[model samples]
Target: MSNVTLHISKNFKELLQFLKSISFSRAIRVGIAVTLPVLMGIQLGYFEIGLALSFGAFWSSPSDVSGSFRHKIKGILISATLVMIVSFIKGYLHFQLWLLLPVLGLLTFTIAYISIYGFRASLISFSGLMALVLSFANESEELEIYQYAVLIGVGGLWYLLLSKAWHRINPKAETEEFLSETFLLTSELIETRGKLVNPHEDHEKLQSKLLKLQSDLTTNHETLREILILSRRTSGWSNYQNKRLLIFVQLIEMLETAISNPVNYHRMDVLFNDHPQYIKRFQDLIFEMSYQLRMISEAGNDHRKLPKNDFMRQCFENVRRDVALLRETKYYEEYLMLQNLLEYQEKQFEKLKSIKRLLGDPNSTEINVIDRKKAKRFIAPQDYDPKLLLRNFSFRSTIFRHSVRLAVTVMIGYALGSIFAFQNPYSILLIVIVIMRPSYGLTRSRAKDRMIGTLIGGAIAFGVVFMIQDPYVYGIMGVISLVIALSLVQKNYKASATFITLSVVFIYAILSPDVLSLIKFRILDTLVGAGLSYAAMLWLWPAWEFVEMKESIEKSVKANKDFLHKIIEYYLLKGHIPTSYNIARKQAFLETSNLSSAFQRMTQEPKSKQREMNKVYELVVLNHNFLASLASLSTYIQHYDTTEASERFKTATEKIAFNLERVVQCLKDKTCNGAGASSEDTTLFDDQLPVFNYLEINTLKSNDTETLRELQEAHLVWEQLEWLFSISGRMLKLSASVKLD
Candidate 1:
C-alpha cells in the first residue's frame, strides 16, 4: 500500500514539473510577442483605436531573420525618427489632407525602397506607414500619436534586450547549425560525383550543386565573420574556432572543384605515383584538418592541442607532397589565383595561435584589436561592380517584377479602402497596402500565416481579458511580449507566427481599455482586414506566368559561356590569369542566385507556368553543374605538375586552348545567326592527328620511370579534355535549341 502511494506521488510530481517547464517556455514566447503591441496600446489607449493603428505599423515592419541587430536597430530608429518628425510637422504646419497625400506617397515609395535594400525593410516600411497613418488620422485626437510612438519605442527596447540576451547565451550555435548544413551539402556533392554515368549529364548536376554550395558557404562564412567580430567585443570570448571554420570552408570549396574536374586528381596521381606515400599522406592530412576543425567547433574554448598522433604525421607528409606536386607542376599559376584565400587562412591561423599564446599567459599584455575599424577591415565588402548588377537586372528583369508588385499593392489598397465601409475602413486599406508587399510569391504565405496568427491572437486576448485584471494583466502581457520577441531569433516561420499571435492578443485584451463587449468587434476588424488583403493579392495583376525562370536560365548560359572564355584566356596566358576570372566567378554566383529567386517566385505563381518553369529550372541546374565542372577542370589544368611531364603536355594544352577558342567563336556565330547548324559542321570531338601532334611535341625529355609515367598521364588527361569539350559543345547546342524554342 505504501509503495503504491509513493509511486502515485512521484508520478504527480513529475507531471507538475513537466507542466511548469511548458508554462515557462510559453511565458517567454508570450512576453516577446506582446512586448511591442502592449506598449503601443498603453501609451496610446482607446481599445480598438490604438490597437488598429499599432497593428498596421507592426504589420508593415516584419522582422528579417537574416539582418543583424545593429542594422535592424539602425533602420528602425531612422524610421521612427522620421515618423516622429512627420508627426511633429503635421502638428506645427497643420498640413491639408490633399497636400499630405502626395507627400505620403513619396515617403511610402522611399521607405519601400529602403526597406527592400536595408536589412530590416519591414521595420522601416512600418515606420513610414505609421507616419502616413498619423497624417491621415485627422479625426483622431492629436495626443494619441505621441502616445503610440512612446509605446512602440518601449516595445522595441524590450524586444532588443531579449534578443541580445538570447544571443549572448548561444552566440555560435546558429553559425554552427549553418555550417553543418553546408557540410551536408558538400557530402551530397561528393556522393553525386561518384554516381556519374554520363560525364556531361552528371557534370552539369555537379556544377549546379557546386554553385549552390558555394553561395551557401559564402553566406554562412559571412554570418561567422559577423559573430567573430561580435565575440571580440566581449572579453574572454575567442574567435579561434571561427578562423578554423573559415579554413574548412576554403578546403571544402577546393574539394568541390577537385571532384568536379577529375583530371586534376588524375594529374596529382600521375606526378606523385612513384612516391605513392605522398598522395596517401596528402589525403590523410586533409582528413585530419577536417577532423580538427569539427573538434574545435564542438569543444569550443576547452579544446587544446592538435591531433599529434602518428596518423597526423602521415597526413602532414601527404600535405607536404601535395604542396610539392603543386609547386612542381608550375601550378603556381593556379595557386596564385587562389593565393589570397590561402593567405587569409594563414593569417587567421596565426591569429588563433596568438590567441592561444595569450590564453596560456595569465598576465598576457597583447592588445586585441577588437574595434569596429579592424572588424570592418577584416570583413571587407565583396567588391561590387555596377556593370554586373546592370547585367543581372537586364537579363533577369528582377527590377520589373518588383516594380509591378509594388504598383499592384498600392492600387489594391486604395480600391479596398474606397470599397469597404467598416467603422474604420482605412484599417482594411492599411492591411492591404502593408501586407501585399513587394513580391507576390511571399505575400500569400505571409498572409495566410498572418490570418491564422491573428485568429489565435484574438482568442488569447479574450482569455487574458477574462482571466486577469489591471496590474497583473499588464505584467503577464509584458512577459508574453518577451516570448514573441525571442521567437524572432528562430528560422522557422511558425515561431514568428506564434509570437505575432500572442502579441496581438495582449495588445487588444490587456493594453487597450476596450470593454469586454467590444472584443468581438476587434476580432471582426482583424478578419476583415486579412480577408481584403488576401483578395487584393489574388486579383491585382496576378502573376500567373513565371517569366523570371526563363530569363534566369538564359542568363546562366551566357554567364557560363563567359566563364569558359575567361578560363581559356587564362590558360593561354600561361601564368597568373587576369582579374577577369574573379569577375566571371562573381557573375556565375549572381546568376545562380537569380535562378533561385526566380524559381521561388514561380512556385507562388499560378499552376499555368509550372511546366515551363520546371523545364527552365532544370536547365539552370544543369548550367550550374557544368560551370562547377569547368571550374574544377580549370583548377586541375592550372595546377598540373608540368616539370616532371614531357613537353607534349604544353603542346597539347595550346591545341586544346585553340580548339576551345574555335568552339567559342562557333557558339557566338550560332547565337548571332540564329540558324540551324549540324554537329558535323562543329567538329564535335573528332580526335584527328593535330590534337595528338600537339600532345607529342609537348612531352618532356626525361628518362626517369616516374617522369615517363607523368608524361603518359598528361597525354591521357589531354585526350579526356578533348572528349569533355566535345560533349560540352553538343550540350550547349542542345541548350540553345531549348532556349530558342
Candidate 2:
C-alpha cells in the first residue's frame, strides 16, 4: 500500500513537471499562428474565415521540432509555398466533381509517395491537409475561391515572422534550457548506471529502464548538438557562450562514454556477490559518482567553489588493495576483472576532475583525452534533395506501397461522401488521409485516439456553446484551444486532437450560429473518417514491425562487424583513433540500441506475431554483451600504445568480424550449417589458466619491479582481448539461434 502511494506521488510530480515544461516559447509561436491571424480576420469582418486561416498556420507547426534560426526560417518559406500550391490546386478545380476526383487521387498518391523524405513529407503532409480545407470553403466566383488561399498564406507568413522574432529576441533562453536539460539528464543517467551495477538488480527490468534512458539520452544529445554546435557555428551567439559551450559539449560527450559501461552487471555480481566488502564499496563509489553529477548541476553560478574529486582519489586506494588481495589467492582472473572495473572508475573520476578544473578556473593544462578524434559537427536537418531521393528511390519500397494504399483509401472515402450527398463531404476524406500510416498498428492506434478525442472534445465544445451567450467568448475559447492544441500536437496527439476538435467547434459557433448542426456533422464525419481509416489499415498494405525484425537483426550484425573491423584497423594503424572509427562504433551501438527498442515494441504487439520471442531476447542480450566487451577493449586500447601487436590477438579479432558476417548471412539465407564453427579456446591470453600452461610465472613477473608492472599491464590487455573473443563466440551461437519460424 505504501509502495502504491509513493508510485502515485512520483507520477503526479512528473505530471506537474511536464505541465511546467510546456514550452511558453512554442505556445507563443502557436498564438501567432492562429490568434494573430484570427484577430486580423475578425478586424476585417472575416470572423467566419478564422478556421481556414488557422489551418494554414497549423500546417507550419511541425517544423518547430528541431531547426536552427536559419533552418526554421527556410522551413517556413518552404511550408508557405507548399500550402499555397495545395490551396491553388484545390481552388482551381472547385465543384468539378468528376475531374477533381481524379486530380485529388493523384495528389494524395504523390504526397504520400514523396513522404519517404522526412522534410518533404512534412511539407507535402501540410499541403495535403490545407487542400482538404480548401475543399471545405463555400465558394462560387474565381476570386472568392482564391481568397481562402490568400488568407491561409497570411496566417503562414504571420507564424513565420513570429518564430523568427522570438529567436532574435531571446536566443540564449533555448540554449540555456538545452544545456541544463543535458546535464540534468546526465545526472539521471549516472544514478541509473550506478543502480545497474547491483548484482541483485532485475535484468529485464533494468534493460527496460535502460531503453527508456537511452531514448531520452539520444534526444538530449541531438538537442545539444543541434542548438549548441550549430547555433554557435552560424555566429548567432557571443564568443564567450560559444567557447564555454564548446568546452561543456566535450565534457558531456566524455560523461556519455564514462556512463556507457557495457560490462554486464551480472558478471560484476558473480565476482563480488559473496564479498559484500568489495560490493558495498563499489556501490558507494558509483553513488559518489552520481553525487558528483548532481553537484555539477547544483554548482550553477558558483563554479569557483564546486566539489572536488578527493573522495574518488581516496577510494582508489581501497580498490587497489582489493586487487592485491585477489592477485595472491590463485584468483588472477578475478583480479584482472576487478582491475578493468577499477580502470573504468578511475577514468570516470579523471573526466569529472577535468570538467571541474575547466569550469572553476576556465584555464587548465592539457587534459587527457581518451578520444583523440577531432570534434566533428553532426548537422541533421531535413533533406530537401528531390534528385537524391529519386536516385535512391525504389518503387518496391514499403513507403511506396503505403502511398498506393493511402490513395485508394482517400478515393473510397470521397466517393462514399459524394454518394451520400453529405453537406460536409470531407467528413470521411480528411480522417482517412490523416490516420493512414505505413504500419497497421499505428493506423489502428491513431484511429482509436482520434475518435475518442473527437467525442470528448465535441462534448466539451457543446457545453461551452450552451453556456456562453457571446460570440467574443467563443472566439476567446477558440484561441485558448488553439494554443493548447499547438503545444501538445506532437507531444500528446490524442489530447491535441481533442483540443483541436473543441477549437474548431467553438470557431463555428462564433461564426455560423448553427452549433447543433455543426456538432452533428462533425461527430458523424469523425466516425466515418475513423471507420474508413480502420478498414484501410486492415485491408491495405499492413507493414508489421515484427515482419521487419529479421532485417533489423541482420543490419545489427553488419554494423557490429564493421565496428570490430574499424577498431582492429585503428589498432593496426598504431595511431590515434580516426573519426571514421568512432563513427563506426557509434553506428554499431545505435544499431544494437535500435534492435533492442524494436524488440520492446514487438513485445507490445499481439503474441501471435511475436515469433521466437525468447530467441530474439537472447540475441539482443548477446549483442549488448558483445558491444559491452568491445567497449571494455576500447578502454584497454586507450592507455596502451598499440605496439608489438600480437598475431594471435589480431587473428582473433579477424575471426570475430568474419564470424559476425557469417551470422548475418545465416540469418538472411535461413541456413546455419557451418555458420557457428566452433573453435578451440586456444587464443586464451591468461597463461596462468590451468588449460593454457604455456608461460612461467617468473617470466611474467620480471626481476625489475617496474618491468614487472609493465608486463602485468600487457597481460591485462591480452585478457581483455580474449574476453572480447569469448563474447564474440557466444554472439555467433546466439545469431545461429535467431529464427523467425
Candidate 3:
C-alpha cells in the first residue's frame, strides 16, 4: 500500500510539473477569449452565436505562439483572414455534397500545401483547415452564412486584441520566460557533463541526454534570438532591450564554452587513476556552478536579483590547490592535462562573473552595442517566393505527398460518414484533420493517442453524468477542461485529447438529455477516424524516414565542414570572430539537431521501414561527436594564446575537411571507393593513436612557459583534427554501407 501510494504521489507531482511547463497565462487568455462570448450570448439568450464565436477563437489560438510582436500579429491576422474565408466557403457549399466534396478536396490540399512556407505559416494554415472542419458542424440557423463567417473573424480579432493587451501588461514576459528556460537547460547540460567526471557513469545514457538537451537548447536559442533581435528592430533599442540582449549574449557564449569544454574521460581516468577524490571534488564544483546558474534562471524568471556568490571561486581555488600539489611531483603529463582543465574552469568562472556583474550591478557599463544592420544577418530570412510552392508540386516533395494524402483522407472520411450515416459525420472529419501528419510516425502516434484518450474519457464521462446532473457544474467543468485541453495540446497530446473529450461531452450533457448515447457515438467516431487516418498514412504515399535519411545526413556533414572551415579561418586571422563564423556554428548545431530529431522519428516508424537502422544511428552519432570535437578545437583556439597555424596543423585540418567532403559525396552519389583508403593514405597524420613521445614531453617540460604553451596548443590541435578525421571517415564508410540513394 505504501509503495502504491508513493507511486501515485510521484506521478501526481510529474503531472503538475507537466502542466506548469505549459504557459498557463496563454491558456487563460485563450479561455477568456473563448468564454467571454458564450457568457455574453447566454446573457442575451443567444447561445448559438456565442458558440460560433468560441469556434473562431479556438481555431485562431494555435497561431498565437511565442515570436516577435510583428510576426505574431501578422500570423494572427492572416489566420483570421483565412478562417473567415474557409468558414464562408464551407458554409455556402454545405447543402450540396457534389460541390462540397470537390471544393473540400481543393481547399484541404491548398491549406496543407501552404505549410511549405514555414512553421508559423503552417500553424496559420492549420487554423484555416480547422475552421473548415468546424464549419461543417455549424447549425446556427439564426445567422446567415456570411454573418457566421464574419462573427468568426470578429472572434479572431477579439483574441488578437486580448493578446496585445497581455503583451502590453508584461512586455518582457515571453523573452524572460524563454531566456530563463534556456538558462535552466544550460544548467542541466552542465550537470550532465559534470557526471562524466565519474569513470563508472553510463556514457551512452549521458550522450543521449546530451543530444536531447542540445536539440531543445538549440530551439530555445533560436526562438529567443528572434524575439530579442526582431523586437529591437521594430521598437528601436532601449535600455531594457540592451540589458536583455546582453544577458542573451552572455548566455550564448556560456553555452558555447560549455559545449567546447573537452570531456576526455579516458585521459582524466589515466591522470587521476589513483586520485578519485579529485574527480569527486571536480564534479561537486561543477554542480555548484550549475546550481548557481539555476538560481540565476529562477531569479531572472521572477524578476529578482541575480546571484553574486563566491562559492565557485572558492571551489576553483581548491581544484587549483590540488593541481599545485601535483606540480611538485614528476607527473608532467598529468600536471599539464590538469592545468589545461583548470584554465577551462577559469574561463567558465570568468563568464559567470561577467553575467553576475551585469545582472547584479546596475551601474556596470559593459553593454556591447550591437550593429543593427549587422544583427539582421543573425535572423534567418523566410522566403515567401511563390516559386517555392510550384517547385514542391512534384511527387518527390514530401509536402506535396502529404497534401494529396490529406485531401484523399478527408474525402474518404466524408464519404464514409455519408454512407454509414454516423450521428455526427463532422466528428469523423474532425478526427481525420486533427490526426493526419506529414510523417507516418506522427500520424500513427496521434491516432493511437486519440483512440486511447477517447476510450478513457468516455468511461470517465459516463460515470460523471450518472453521479451529477447539475448543468451549472457541467458548465464549469467544461470550461476548465477546454482550457486544459488547449494548454496540453502542444506538450502532451494524449492528455489534451482526454481533456478535449471531457470538454465536448460535458458541454453536450448540458444541452442534451441522453448523455450515454453521446459518449457511445464519440468513441465510435473517434475509433473510425483514428483507424482511417492511420490506414491512409500506411497506404497513401507513406513518407518513409529512410527516404530522407541521406539528405539529412548530407546536410549535417556539409554544415560541420563549413563550421570547421570557419574555425580554421578564425585561427589563421585571430582577431574578433566574424559573423560568418557564428552563422556557420549556428547552422552546424541546427543541422546536427535536425538529424538527431529525424533519427528519433524514424525509430518510431515500423520496423520494416527502418532500413539501415544501425548504420544510420552510427552516422548520427558520428556527426554529433564530430561537432563536439570541433567545438573542443574551437574553444582552445579562441581562449588560449597560441602560435600561428603550422603547416602540419593546416595539413591535418585539410585532410579532415576532405574526409567530410568525401562523406557528403558518398551520401549524395551512393558510392565510395573505400572508407579506409583515403584516411589511411594520409602522410602527415598516421593511423596509430596520437601520442606524445617521452622526449617531446621532457623537452616541453624544460622549455619556457610561453614555448610550452604554444607547443601544447599545437599538440591539442593535431590530436582533435586527427580524431575528427577518423569520425568523418567512419561517416563516409557508414553512408556508403547504407543504400539510401
Candidate 4:
C-alpha cells in the first residue's frame, strides 16, 4: 500500500510539473479570442446568440501557431466564409439520423483527409467540420440564416482584428520570440552533442533522448520559420534592421545544420577512450558556443546588447595544436576525423561571429536590402500547392486511414444518440470525433484526458453554477474558463476539458437558470461519447508506428545511400553540382529525420515491440555522422576550389560508392550480415572492398615545397573520405542485423 501510494504521488508531481510548463502567452491568446466576442455580444444585449458565435470565433484559435499576420487574417476570412456558407444552408437541409449519419461520415472523412494540403488548409478543414456540427443546433434555425452567418463572421473577424492589433504594435515580437526559442534549442543541441562524446554516459539512452529532442527542436524551428516567412516589416526600421533580420533567418538554418550533423557517438567514444583531454576540449568548445548562443537568445528576447564571445581565436589555437598532435600519430583516420570536427566546429563559430557583428558593430548597421525580392524570399524546406491533394488519396496514405477511422467512429457514436433518442446528440458525436486520433497511443491518451477532464469539470461546474447566482458574475467566470480551456487544449487536454466544461456551464447559465441539470447532462453525454470513442479506438484500423518501423528504416537507408552516391559522383566528375544532387540531399535529410521520428515513436511503445532498438540507433548515428563528413569535405572544396581531382581519389570514391550500393542491395535482400561485402575480395583493383582501402603510397618527385603542401592537403581529405566509407561498411552490418521480419 505504501509503495503504491508513493508511485501515485510521483505521478501526480509529474503531472503538476507538466501543467506548470504550459505556455502563458498561448493561454492569453485564447483568452483574448474567447473574451472579445463575448463582450461584444453582451454589449449588444444578445448574450445567448453571441455565445454561439464564440464557438465559431474560437475556430480561429486566434491564429497563433505560426504564419504571417496577414495569413492569419486570411485564415479568419476563409474560416468565416466556410462557417457562413454552412450556416446559410444548415436550416434548409434538416439532419435526420439515417441521412445525417452518411453525410457526417463523408464530411468528416473528406475534410480530415484533405488536411494534408498544409497547416492553414488543415485549420480550414477543422473549421468546416465544427461549423457543420454547430449549424445543426436546435436554436440555430430560429435565427435567420444571414443573422447567424453575420454573428459568426463578426466573431471570427473580431478575434482576427484583436490578434493583428497586438502584432501591429510590435512586428518583431513573434520573430524575436521564435529566434530566442531557436537559439535556446540550439544550446540544448550543443549540450546533447557533449553528452554524445562523453564515454561514461549510456550512449543508447543518450541517442533516445537526442531523438526526442530532435522532434521538439524541429517543431520549434518550423514554427519560428513560418512566422518569419509570413511576417513583414514596417518602414519604421532602417535597412540595417531588415538586413539583421535576414541574418537571423540565416542563423536559424545554420542551427539546423548543427542539430542534424552530430558525429557517431560510439565511434567518438572509442576514439577518445584513452584521450579524455580531447573529449574535454570539445565539450568546453561546445559549452562556450552554447553560452554565446544563450547571449544571442537574450538579445532576441530583450533589446539588450549581446556579450561578445572573445574566445574564438583561443579555441582555434587550441584546435590547431590538437590537430598538430594528431598529425604526428600513426593513425591517419583519427587525425582526419578530428580535422573534420575542426571544420564542422568552425562553421558554428563563424555564425556566432556573424551574429555578433550584426548585433554589436555600429558600422554594420548601414547595410541596405540590395535586392528586396531576394531578401524577402526566404523559402522554407517546402511550400506545396493545394491542387496536389489528390496525389495522397490512396490506401497507403496514413492520413486517409485516419480520416476513414474518424468518420466511422464519430458516425457510430452519433448513431447511438440519434437511434436511442438522446437529448444532446451533437455533444456525444463531438466528444468522439475530437477525442479519436490517428495513432493508438494518442487515442488512448486523449480518451483518458477527456474522461478525467469532463468528470472533474462537471463536478466543478455543478458547484460554481449555484454558488454564483448573479448572471454578471457567471459571465466573467465564462470568460475566465474559456481562456483556461483554449490555452490548455493542445498542451494538456484534461485541463482544457475541465475549463471547457466550466465555461459551457457558466455560459449556458445566462440562458437557463437550472445549472445543475446542465452539468448532469454534460457529464452524462461526455461519458457516453468517451465510452464510444474508447471502443472504436480498440476495434478501429489499428496502426502502431513501431509496427511500421521496418519500412521507414529501409527507406532511410536507401535514401542515405543514394545521397552518398550523389556526393561521391560530384567529387569524381569534378563538375558543377546538379539539381539531382540537391534533390538527393533533401531526400536524405527528410528520410533521416523521418527515421528519427520513427525511433521516437518506438520509444513510446511497449519495449517488447522494439525489435532492435540499439541497431536502429547505430544506423541513425552512423548516417548522421557520415552526412556530416560529407558536408565537411564539401566545405573543403569551397575553400580550395583550385585543386583538380586526384586519380587516387577517383578510384577510392568509385569503390566507396560501389560498396555503398552493395549495402543497399544487402538490406533489400535482407542479408545485412555484411558477408558478400568481404568476399568481393575477388581481389581485382583490390580484393572485395577491404575495410580500409590502403592506397599504395606513391612518393611524389615534386621538389617544390608548395606542391608537397598541396599533396599533403589532398592526402588529408582522402583520409576523411576513407573514414566515411568505413562508416558506411559498418552501417551495412547494422542494417543487416535489423529484424525486418
Candidate 5:
C-alpha cells in the first residue's frame, strides 16, 4: 500500500510538470477571449447580442494566442471600429438597407485582399452587416450605435489587458514552444539525411520533411511577427527575439535542401574533397553564422544593436564567394539552381539584417513587412476559376450545404424563441451561426467538445449568480464578468465558451434581479442554440466530400513526376540542368496535410465511402513513399562523380529514358494501363523508338579521370533510376486499382 501510494504520487507529479510545461497562461487568455464577447452582450442588455459578439471572439482566440498582442489588439480595434462606423452610418446617415449587403461584401473583399489584418476583416464585415440589419429593424439610430461602440470598446480593451498580463507571466513561452517543435523537426531531417542510402527514397523523404518544415516556418513567421509587434509596444524583447530566431529557421531550410538534392551534394562533396582547406573554412563559416544569429537573438532581448561581428561578416562573404564560384565554374552543371538557392538565402539574411536594424533604431515607427517570400503557393486550379461562386452555390458543393444548414439554424432559432416566448430570437440564430463553423471529419468531436464546455459554463454561471444576491451585485458582477472575459482571451473554444457562459449568467442575474428564473431561461436558450447548430450541421450535408484529399494526391503525383522529369532531363541534356526538387518538397508537404485531413474525413463518413476513401488514401501514401525513394536515388547519383560510362550504364540509361517517356505518355492520356511495350521488346536499343536511339553520351578525354568518375557515377544513377521506375510503376498500378473503383 505504501509503494502504491508512492507510485501514484510520482505519476501525479509528472502529470503536473507536463501541464505546467504546456502554457497555462495561453489557456487562461483563451478563457478571457470568450468572456469579452459575453461582456459586450451584457452591456447591450441582450443575451443574443452578447452571443453574436462571442462568436467572433471564439474564432479569433486561436490566432490571438499565437499572434502578437499588437496584431490581436489591432484586429479587435479594426473590427470594433468598423462595426461602430458602419452602425453610425446606418443610424445617422440612414443608408439604404438594400445597399448594406453589397457594401459590406465589397469592404470585406478589399480588406481581405489588401492587408495582413487576418480574420478580423471577416469578423468586421459580418458584424457590420449584423449591426446594419439591426439598425434597419429597430430604427433606433445614433444612440444605439454609440452604445454598441462603448460596449465593444470595453470588451476589446478588457481582452487586450488580460492577454498582456498573461504574456507577462509566461514571457513568450508559447512562441518558444512552437520554435522548439520546429527545431526538433529540423534535427529529425538532419538525422535522416545523415543515414540516407537510396537517393530516390532520400529525396522523397527529404522533400516531405522539407515541406513540413516550410509549413512550420510559415506558421512561426506569423507568430514571430505578432510577438515582434507586441514587444515593440510593451518594451519587451520576447517577441523581437522570437522573430530574429527565424534566421536560424531559414538556414536550416537551406541546409536541408542542399543535403537532399544529389546535384548540390556532389558539388559540395567535390569542392570539399578537392580543397580540404576550403572545407575547414566552410565549417568555420557555418559555426560563425550560427553563433552570430544566437548573439543577435540575445542582444535583441536587451534592446541593444545587433553585433556587426567580423566572424559574421567573413562568413557572409565566404558564402557569397562560394556561390559565385559555383555559378562561374558551372561545376555542378546545375549551377543556376545553386545560384537561385543562394539568392533565396541572401534575401533571408537581408530580412534578418533589416529586423536587426529595426531593433537598433528604437524611435523608428514604421511597420515594415518582412521580405521573406518563402511560402509556397498551393492554390488549387479550381480556386482560380471565375465560376467558383456559381460552383459553390451548386447542390453538389459544401457551400450550398452550409447555406441549407444556416437556413435550418434560423428556423430552429425562431421556433425555439417562439416556443419559450424569449424576448430575442436573433440570439439563438447568432449562437447557431457561431458554433456551426465548417469542419472536415471532426465535426462530431468538435460538437461534443462544444457541448461539454457549454454545460460546464452554464453550471458555473448559475452558481455565481446564486451566490451574489445584492442589487449592487450587477455592477460587481460586471467587474467579475471582465475578469472572466479577460481569462478567455487566448484559450481554446471550449474553455472560452465556459467563461462566456459564466459571464453571461452573472450579467443576466444582476440585471434581471431574479437569479433562478434567469438561470433557467439562459440554460434553455443555450441548449436550444447548441442543439440546433449540431443538428443542422449533421443532417444537412450528412457527408462532407474529401475533395481536398483527392486534389492533394493528384498534386503530389504531378510534383513527383515533375521532379523526376527535371532530374532525367538534367542528366540527358549533359549541360547541367536544375532539378525541381524544391517544388516537389512543397507539394509533398501539402499532400501529407491533405492525406491526413482525408483520413479524418473518411472516419466520419458511412462505411462504404470510408472504405473507398481509405483505399484511395493508401494509394496516395504509397505514391508518397515511392517519390521519397526516388529523391534518395537522385541524391546518390549527384554525389557520385565519375568520368567514364560503361556499356551496362548506357543500356540502363536507355531503359530508364524509354520507361519515363512511356510513363509521361500514360499520364498525358490519363490511362491506368502499363506502357504499350511488348515483353519480347527487351532489347538494349529499339530501332523503332527513334527518341531512345538518338540519345548520345558526351565524350571525355581518356586521361580525364574526374570526367571518367562522373561518367561511372552517372551509370550507377541510371541503374538506380531503372529500379525506381520499376517500383513506382508497380505502386502506380496498385493505386490505379483503387482510384478506378
Candidate 6:
C-alpha cells in the first residue's frame, strides 16, 4: 500500500512539474489567442465573426515556437497567409462537391509536400491543413464566404500582434526557459550515466534512456543555437546575451565531456571490480554534480540567487582522494583511464561553477566576443529551394508517397462520411489529418492514442454535462482544456487528445443544446477516422524503418568518419577549432541520434519486418561507441597540449578512414573485401612511434605536469585511434552481413 501510494505521489509531482514547463506556458499563450476572440464576440453580438477569428488564431499558433524574433514573425506570417488562402478556397468550393473533392486532393498534396522544407515549414503546412478542415464548419449566411476568410486572416494577425506584445513584455523568457530545460535534461543524463557505474544496473535500459535524452538535447541545443547565436549575429551582443551565450557553450561542452566519460562501461567495471569503493566515489561525485546542475536550473527558472556548489567541490575532493588510493592498487595501467574519467568530471564541475558565476553576475567579463562570421556558421540555414520540391516529387520520395497516401485516405474518408450521412462528416477527415503520419509506427501509435483519448474525454464530458448546465462554466473549462491539450500535444499525445476532445465538447455545449449527442458523434467520428488512418498507414506505401535502416546507418558512419577527420586535422594543426569541425561534429551527433531513433522505431514494427534484428542492434551499439570514442579523443586534445602530429599518428588515422570507407561501400554495394585489419596494419606504425611505458614513466620521478600531459595525450590518441579502427572493421563486417544492396 505504501509503495503504491508513493508511486502515485511521484507521478502526481511529475505531472505538476510538466504543467509548469515552458510547453505549458506556450499553450496558455495560444489558448488566450484562440479563446479571447470568441468570448469578445459573444459579448458584442458578433459570435460568428469571433469564431472565424479564433480558428485563424488557433491554426497560426502551431508555428509560434521558439527561435529568433525575426523567425517567429516570419513563420507566423507564412502560416497566416496559408490559412487565409486555404480557407478562402475551401469556402468557395464547399457548395460544389464535385469540384471540392478534386481540389481538396490537390490542396492536400501540395500543402503536405511543402513540409519537406523543414520543421517550421511543416508546422506552417499543418496550419493550412487545419484551416482547410475547419472551413467545413457551417457558417452564418450573414457574412459572405470571402468576408469570413478576411476575418480569419485578421485573427491570425491579431495572434501575431499578441505574440509580439508578449515577447516585448518578456523578451528573454523563452530563451531562459529553454536553457534551463537543457540544463535539467543534461542533469538527468548525468544521473543516468552515473547508474552505469553499478554492476547490477540494466546497462541496455540505461543506454536507451541516454540515447533518448541525447535526441531531446539535440533538439534543445538546435533551438538555443537559433535563438542565442543568431540573435548575437543580428542584434549584437549585450552583457546579458554574452552571459547566456557563454553558459550555453559550457552546457554543450559539458555534455560532450559527460558523453565521452563512459567510453567502455565494461572496461570500467573490470578495472574497478576489486576496488568497488572507487566506483562508489566516482558515482557519488557524478550524482552530486547532477544535483548541483538541477539546482542551477531551478535557480535560473525562479530568478533566485544561484546556489553555492560547495558540495560539488567536496565531491571532487572525495573522488581525488579515491584516485590517490587507486595508485597503490595492482591496477597501475588502468589508473590512467580512471584518471582521465576523473579529469572529465573535474572539467564538468568547473563548467557548472562557471555557469553559476556567469548567471549570478551579468557584468562578468568571462565571455569573449566570438567572431561574427564564425558564429554565423553554427546556424543551419533552411533551404527553401523550389528545386527540392521538384526533386522529391516521385514515388521514391517518402514525402511524396506520404502526401499521396494522405490525400487518398482523406478523400475516401469524406466519401464514406457523405454516403453514411454522418452529422459531421468533416470530423472524419479531421481525425485522419490529425492521426496520420509519414511513418507506419507513428501513425499506428497516434491512432491508438486518439481512440483512447476520445473515449476518456467523452466520459469526462458526459459527467460534466450531467452535473452542470451553466454556459459560463462551460466557457471557462473550454479554454482551460484547450490550453492543456495544445501544451501536451507534442509531449504527451494521449493526454493531449483527451483534452482536445474535452475542449471540443465544451465549445459545442456553448453553442448547441444536445451535449450528449455531440459527445457520441465525436467518439464515433474518432473511431472511424483512427481506424481508417491505421489501415491507410499499414497498407498504403508503408515506409518501414527496417527498409530505411541501411541508408541511416551509412549516413551515420560517414558522419563519424568526417568527424574523425576533423579531429585528426585539429590534432595536426593544433590551432583554433574550425567551423567545418563544428559542422562535422553537429552532423555526427544528429545522424547518430537519427539512427538511434530509427532503430527504436524499427523495433516497434511488426516482427517479420525487423530483418536481422540482432545484427542491427549490434551495429547501433557499435556506431554509438564509435562516436563516444571519437568524442573522448577530441575532448582530450581540445583541453590539453600535445606534441606535433607524427607520421605514425597520420598512418593510424588513414587506416581507420579506410575501414570506414569500406563499411560505407559495403552498405552500398553489399560486398566487403579485406574488411578486417591486417597484422601489418596494426603493427606497421608501432615500431616507428615512441612507447610511453608506464613503468619507465614512473621511474623518471618527474613532476613536470607538461611532460606528464604530453605523455597522456600521446597514449590516449594512439589508443583512441586503435579503438576507432577496430570498431570500423566490425562495422564493415556487420554491414556486409546485413546485405543492404
The best candidate in terms of TM-score: 6
lDDT of 2 by residue, 66-143 (tens): 534666666676676677667767777655667767777788777666677765355556555655544555442434
In candidate 4, which residue pairs clash?
Answer: 672-736, 680-688, 681-687, 681-688, 683-687
Report residue 678 deviation for candidate 3 (angstroms): 2.4
Candidate 1, overall lDDT? 0.48
lDDT values for all models: 0.48, 0.67, 0.81, 0.67, 0.49, 0.83
**To one decimal, what is the Cα RMSD in angstroms of model 1 from the true structure?**
9.9
How many Å off is the CA of 673 in candidate 4? 11
Worst 10 residues of 4 by lDDT: 693-702
Error of 6 at 681 (Å): 4.5
Order the candidates by TM-score, highest first. 6, 3, 2, 4, 1, 5
Q: Where does candidate 3 clash, by residue pair? A: none
Q: What value of lDDT does candidate 2 attain over all alpha carbons?
A: 0.67
**Number of clashing residue pairs in every model?**
39, 0, 0, 5, 47, 0
List model 3 lDDT by residue over 191-251, tens digit each. Answer: 9888866778887788778888888898898898888888843343365677777778777
Residue by residue across 67-135, what tens digits does model 6's lDDT show?
A: 888888889999988998888877767446666677788889889998899888888988988888777
lDDT, model 4, position 666: 65
TM-scores of the models, in the order given: 0.62, 0.84, 0.93, 0.81, 0.56, 0.94
Residue 407, model 1: lDDT of: 43
Encode model 4's per-residue lDDT on 477-520: one tens digit a residue.
88788777876777689999999898989988988997777787
Which is the winner by lDDT between candidate 3 and candidate 4?
3
The C-alpha local distance difference test score for the whole of candidate 3 amounts to: 0.81
Residue 40 in model 4: lDDT: 78
Q: Candidate 2, clashing residue pairs?
A: none
